[model samples]
Target: MATLVLAACGTDAAAPADRDDVGARVFAANCATCHGPDLGGTDRGPPLLHEYYLPDHHPDVVFATAIANGVQAHHWDFGPMPAIGGLSDDEVAAVVAHVRDEQRRAGLME
Candidate 1:
């Protein structure tokens, strides 16, 4: 039974994710708790779907840094945000991509 299970699992542990799903997957797992399921604001966190977050204003680096180093509550009333240290730079990038895509879709880019 163990051999059958292992055989079904295959040898490649690092299977690639579908290109379109990367950002959302990362976001759902890591950022969704605070940022909300639809990237909208929650009681604990501000909305990423707002115009204030456009890359021209907040920039991608800001997102990366905020996730890595945490954020202070200067813009919203959510209070200070703490650093999320478990996510890697790549995962952070993926999360950022997902957020930017969401931001665009929300018409926040305008």
Candidate 2:
């Protein structure tokens, strides 16, 4: 399979085997468009950095389901989040990890 390693900041994101930050790469490739580079809400979707996603409020598993099955618009007017395709389980986990880490950094969770 031919995979492209597209990078924006890091200088060592050339070889896929050399990647140490899989979550960041995955987010950039998938969720960055709607979630923004910083995970802040954009015109398309709500920010993953919001307090609504606290570990107690929305568990990590919820993210996994949403990614696979898509989510309805309950909090914003962005409408339903259609299921994103072509990602492996590990890749989905990586994206979840990335979002959770950013949420913690933003003080949305303890």
Candidate 3:
């Protein structure tokens, strides 16, 4: 018997890569629904752009974990952040970057 090898499909089959744009889109899609378009917090979500949270402390990691596993971590004190398992790691990276950038611009970075 002879073996059969299958070649991979065209690159078009893969999803487009746009970390920054995707991050913004993702935030607008999933987060903005609760966090607001400016990330200024909403009636449901807590403020993530001010002194309430410190980005330098471990924001990127914390944000990633919270998104991946839901906000059952210590953030419940503020409000329950629903889990967004639909967001990929890269999307999370973009959100974190956007938050960091905003924090820096606001002089809230520690």
Candidate 4:
């Protein structure tokens, strides 16, 4: 797995409310099925807010790729995530921002 630093997104002081709204919408529309509404993970997927993931995997580029292209099922057998082709680059960025912020608030991101 890649060790992605959280600082790359810059100071966590820019448009937080907007990020949260975008993030919630993106997650609801695309990730809620697998990741769950509260981001607590689900039977079909691992928790995004867990200590094992959020901190190390929150890089913008990595997340962008994961959302835009989908990830290969390397650590789990559930399978790769389908490409969220419906989202534009800006939308993807917002989602990533949302995930990072929420994780950070949850004390999962560093």
Candidate number with the higher lDDT (1 or 4)? 1
RMSD score of candidate 3 (Å)? 9.8
User: Alpha-carbon error at 97 in model 1, in Å?
Assistant: 0.6
Q: Cα lDDT of model 4 overall?
A: 0.70
Q: Which digits, one per residue and each the tens of the lDDT, describe model 3 over residues 1-98?
A: 00100011112232434444666788888888777788788777776776656755654666766666676535535566767866655566666666
Ranking by lDDT: 2, 1, 4, 3
Cα RMSD (angstroms) for every candidate in the order listed: 10.3, 7.8, 9.8, 4.5
> Model 2 reaches what TM-score against the true structure?
0.79
Q: Model 1 segments beyond 4 Å from truth?
A: 1-20
Per residue, candidate 2 scores C-alpha lDDT tens digits across 8-105 of: 21233334332326778988988888989999878998888887877787776778778878989887899998887897766666677677777767
The runs of at least 3 residues in candidate 3 whose Cα sits more than 4 Å from the true structure, single-residue gaps closed, are: 1-18, 73-78
- Candidate 1 versus truth, CA RMSD in Å, comes to 10.3
Overlapping backbone residue pairs in candidate 4 total 0
lDDT of 4 by residue, 1-110 (tens): 11222342344444768767876898899988888888787888767777645635545677777776788876567778787778765566667777777788887656
lDDT of 2 at 41: 76
What TM-score would candidate 3 get against the native? 0.70
Task: Identify the leading candidate in terms of TM-score.
Answer: 2
Tens digits of per-residue lDDT, candidate 1, 74-105, equal 88999988887776555666667678777767
